[model samples]
Target chain A: MSSTTLDPSRRGAHAGTGGAPAGGMSGTSTGPGPSFFRVLNSEFIKFRTLLSTLILLGCTVLVVVGFGALSAWGTGQFAEAAATDPQAAAAFAAQGGDLAVGVPTSGIAFAQLILGSLGVLLMSSEFTTGMARSTFAAVPKRIPAYAAKLLVVMVTAFVLTAASVYLAGLMALPILDNYNLNLDLASPQSVKMLLVNSLYVAAVAAIGMALGSLIRNSAGGIMSLVGLFFVAPIAFQLIPGDFFVEARKYLPGNTVEPMTAVQHVPDTLEAWQAAMVLGAWVVIPVVLAAVLLKKRDV
Target chain B: MIEARGLTKVYGDKTAVAGVNFTVEAGRVTGFLGPNGAGKSTTMRMIMGLDRPTSGTVTVNGSPFARHAAPLRDVGALLDAKAVHTSRSAYNHLLAMAATHSIPKKRVHDVIEMTGLADVAKKKVGGFSLGMGQRLGIAAALLGDPQTVILDEPVNGLDPEGVVWVRNLVKYLASEGRTVFLSSHLMSEMAVTADHLIVIGRGRIIADAPIQDIITGKGQIRTRVRTDQPDRLMHLLAGDGVSVELQENELLEVTGLDPRRIARAALDSHVMIYELTPLQASLEEAYMELTKDEVEYHSLITTGAAAPVQSGGN
Candidate 1:
């Protein structure tokens, strides 16, 4: 049975000798290992094939759109109440009377959480399922695959966040117009918010992937991501020390607000400083993960 | 060809694989046989460059696996059947692995049909039975049509037909002048499948020789005797360089004694002997004798006292 099933001539006939130059030349001498682009393509295929990853991405879109609509309605209510109360009016005026600009990014927090977990799961599942063996066996250099996965993950998170934020703005447009509120989606502040928030989410996803590679477990990576993005900020605020208060401003999550503000808010980081902080948050862990991935056993 | 020079792996306080050296040549099936927890998988992983060796080097062909220009093209390995994400379909899994080396879509489809995974190619691998998973792994290994094939227990969890299919497939692969290195814990399977054998136990090489030599060599001589006066013959055989074990009412298994010596003693002692047969060691017996002292986790089975079985079970 196996003799009939494994006919080499028949199998070879379909293979078409396309890689003969690489295969035959490399038969005695090495031809081409996994180049960066090939590994990226491989990682992208792996990234898109899993149903769980698609489900998580879908949930991110739903949550972002839902929160955008809800925030628009709440802002409309505040604007309506401003006419009857001086304090409410003052608050509305202080908000620049354009609460609608912030509505599109109202669900950025949830998007970061969901996409960050997705990043963690992507890398951790490789180790958990023993897929690392096959992956590294193909590209034994190891760093190219790790870098390729990181690029795939960060790019997906950025594109998804930016696209979802834009969709949310479109969805919230009519809801804000019902209360006589004007929102210019093309306004510089709105565009700044979208780009900065998207970049911030991409950074978070990179950090999550780094944690995943380092920890090699899904739950642990996700928990560390949550602790860095969610728990640390609240815990730092609750602490009484001045150092904690100052350190909170440098957190990756806090950087997004300062970065997107029309003007620098007092007591917050400068835009350039915030960008550098976020860049550090991303680069440090990613470089560390790549080094360890190359050095350690798969 | 594959070569290892003092390859070793140490984890925490324990050494999973100690310093070991051996070479696997091309154009033949080399079976790596051992009991469970014998570092067969670790050695295979090192050869594929998935695990870093502690203080030694292992090279496939001429250079280390990592140094090859195209690893997947030069060598293919199925280190484990579950070395795949369960949520992905079998087809997608092969496609993704193939993409790493720019393997064509046609080749991907070819491997799927070749491994008989065409029926469930679209289904999630998590839902696959063990046999189906093994087939998927084999398909992935052959995706590049590599020159060297390394499989760690390819017949594991396979049905009888699947087992025979793998046996013939590997032999056919070796016949094509490719290097085929396979691993299994089953001695009977290795007896029929492997041309050369490298037996490992407790992370050490117990025997590295041709399959026939391992079967016939290192086996002691033993003769079985059946006598009416077994007690008298047993006493007569009790001497230096002799051991006797009673099998039944009139049967004795005598070691370190030639059949002629036993018969002469039986006749001189007026002990009527009916059956005196010499026993040639089978592969199973030879393997047991070779690895009896090298087994790492010896099961403690006492007649009256009992102990819990350890975690490492095949």
Candidate 2:
């Protein structure tokens, strides 16, 4: 290690300020401050630096592709069974004859779970590991950092999910071709499903980040996300009440189905209503988290 | 220069930092000395704008820390040693912080080498020892080469060499006309390092003055005298504000009187005195005298191995 003495030449113009007016150093900084884009770069650096975060992202891709291949094989077997049994033929007719198109996105459930937990961990670990102090100390306005982190989480989630789903579709092509099933990935319905599912996963990841910020604990944030997306839907179904049945349609997880459906299924929300409800789910928690994060001590 | 005016912080019902005012001037090392839980960390947090003051303001240079165009360039602080993500490597942690202010990569490498973390800069912080963590914290604090530097217990977990390095570093920063505000509970460290001292206790500023003044201000001048006629000397030294305690058979500790006065009195009284040594109070005693009443938790003094018998049974 070098000696602690600083090189005098490297000492900026602020050095030798003993003759300067007392308390006149306020606006002396000529260096760049934390602009939004700079803070966004910082947040991106933080997001990609963790090994655990990268592992979780890799797991999301693996689960999506693995489920896609399995779903394609299962759909081929069912299509072949439909030719032999009248009962199987009736079930096949009920399934819209385009089962292969949905095969790529069959792992949307697991993708949401993994990516959402990742979102929670990213924000929660900041507080848990005491990194918020350094983070806010750099950009004291604080909201920029929050917004930057949110943008990073959402954009990464959307892009990763989209790419993974498309890759899964490519992988499923040969398997589906064995059953003579025509699955066109470039079809409008397939594109809609990919785009909507990617956006849904992005929204869920954002909600997870909001929960992480609000709760500031990894386990608590992930549990609350799971409860909102998984348990609440099942509980609402088993309760057997009109309010819960109605409430189930507005659940953030439930909205993905209505918005991604080929047609407006009976007793489900319209695409616009489900879109609005999902938007509310993301906006309310995000705004609350940002405001509280700004107001609270690091 | 960092200035705090009527700064206060209340957590729920307890006030962590009560209304206090002090200015840390440039070109000197100002030591913030206090016992644990005496509001040193809370006050520093207020100055950093990490914690909002309940009813007052603290400004770095001339404005609040958050209002600076480039806060890192104007002021750098080591609020906590662990104020970093443990899972990240030290280099990446500093890289992320440096990116916020557009600090160049060369400066990041400079701070790393300066702080003796070049060997472990790529290692994950979670596996680092406390000393390594402290070194990393100091590296981050100096990353900005700020005009004002605030470090809370910078040498808490450092080795002797590291401690000496920090001492010289702060002094060097001050020599270049930068403001260096350091906090430590160790009065001995403050005595050797700080040019000025601001002593706080129980969320209050108990003393603020030059380091030498604090060492000799609150404590009385004591003279240890050994004489053949202890009783006579004690009798002769009895006066207003003068106390003479007979520590042993012929040794007497005289307080509130200088050695010259005691010798004069002994010479005039015709009493022989062999030894008279004037005792200068150390900063540790001075600090204990200042914060004696303000210590929140007092450790019980164990006199000996003998147990006291209880008079009443429960």
Candidate 3:
């Protein structure tokens, strides 16, 4: 069974279904068949082929573009009043008065919500609909499937968010120019905002994926994501204690403020501390979900 | 070939699949026949590495299923018809699964054609009938051209024509020396399709043998003797363990006696026998005989002794 059997063609051959040729790796070959590269390609294909996923991607773009245009108009109205009122002068100075850089991704919150839900649906649906059986059947290591899906989710989240932000910037240019305010998509500050917001959304999507894998319920996963980003921060504030204030800095949702701020805000976590907090948010749940997935019955 | 050694799955307090070993050899259709909750699906899932077994180990060819580098090429399983995102088109679903193995586009279309899903390939699976959904699932299973094929209740929603198509397909696959492990409670279908069977009840295998042995090995053979004098035939054949039941005033069902003995007795008694047909034990009876006592959880509402009737008559 060692020499003549090692032809690779006949090694793992069971009953031949006998129409198409054997796929890339036949049964005869041994040792870690579906490499990470192959798994990544598989995950990419799974990511793009669904209509629901595409619809969510499309909605992210539309929301970003629409909100940028609206925010441009809002900033223009505020700029006109800054010259007339002393109180408005103070507010305009606080925003740097050239607010067009911020208009492009004013809808990052909604973008996070939609793309995060996309991440949740991608994984949770696999289990809810029984595709996990087929998925795990193909990549039984379980971790490969989990990691591949996470890569797919995070990459899509980054790309879609960045593209939406860019399109929003382009759309906001004319709206901002009508008020004689300068908007530059090429400026260092503008690019930093795009990169930071896109990464923030990517992190949020990863969190959503972890919740989905752990919860395995669509509504439940999305709800948990919402609780983390939207509800937790406000609830922490209303509770009114120094512990809550300190704990709020560690919340995954609070990382974006420190990242996007030009100068670190007073009484807030520094940029490096926030990055570590975000890293922990992604690493812990993802590892836990992967372990549980391998342990549970499909 | 699929081999299991002490493959077991225990969920919290309840034991679903007890420690049991079985081998699914290549070159034949091995039917995993079991009652509703008898752990057939559980075993298949474990084989696919979808479930972590509590103790035992199962291997496809030589290594554990998940350990395979290209598992799709090793095994293709249709665990359920609805194992798909119903929002996606049947074609796209196959395309995504195919992409995972780097299987080409042509094979995706080929399986769609082979499974007779050409018309509905572009349609969303959510709107599909159960039969169509089963066809899609079958297409997905065949996407990798895997060596070993595992199907759970492959014929559940198929029409008679579709069922026949699947039967022929499996037989052809086996003819090519491939391993086929399928589970179905439809004894009649198994009777025609499977070469060997492993009958499981309550997570225990009651009998594992060739189909013929299952029918003939466990019970007495009955011969139907249609005579003009039913009463005469019954009385004539009655002796010792022999018992005859009269039906339709002319037909006598004789058990514990072979056809030759019945004919000899009729000749001696001068009773004219019209139709002397021998009835072999059906798989239904054979299965009943196999599981009559082993049912871990029997239903409270007692239905006919469907198992014993056919087993005893045979």
- Model 2 clash pairs are none
Model 3 alpha-carbon drift over 4 Å, by segment: A1-33, A96-98, B218-314
lDDT of 2 at B240: 91
Question: Looking at candidate 3, what is the lDDT of residue A147?
Answer: 93
Best by TM-score: 2
Tens digit of per-residue lDDT, candidate 1, span B1-314: 78889999988877878999998877678999987778899999999988898879998877899988878877889889978999999989988888887777887888898889989999999999989989999998887777788999999889999999999988878776667899997777887899999988788887788887666543244789998888889899998778899999988998777788889998887888999998764344545554455434333322212121111111
Better of 2 and 3 by lDDT: 2
| Chain A TM value for model 1 | 0.90
Give per-residue CA lDDT, model 2, range B1-314, as digits (tens): 88899999999999988899999988889999987788999999989999999989999888999999888888889989979999999999999999998888888899999999999999999999888888888888888778789999999889999999999999888877888999997777887899999988778887788887666643367889999999999999999988999999999999888788999999999999999987765345555554455434233212312111111100
- The model with the greater TM-score, 1 or 2, is 2
Which residue runs of candidate 2 sit more than 4 Å off their true CA positions? A1-6, A10-21, B218-286, B289-314
Better of 1 and 2 by lDDT: 2
Candidate DockQ values, in order, are: 0.28, 0.40, 0.27
What does the lDDT read for residue B14 in candidate 3? 83
DockQ of 1: 0.28
DockQ score of candidate 2? 0.40
How much is the lDDT of residue B266 in candidate 2?
100
TM-score of each prediction: 0.84, 0.87, 0.83
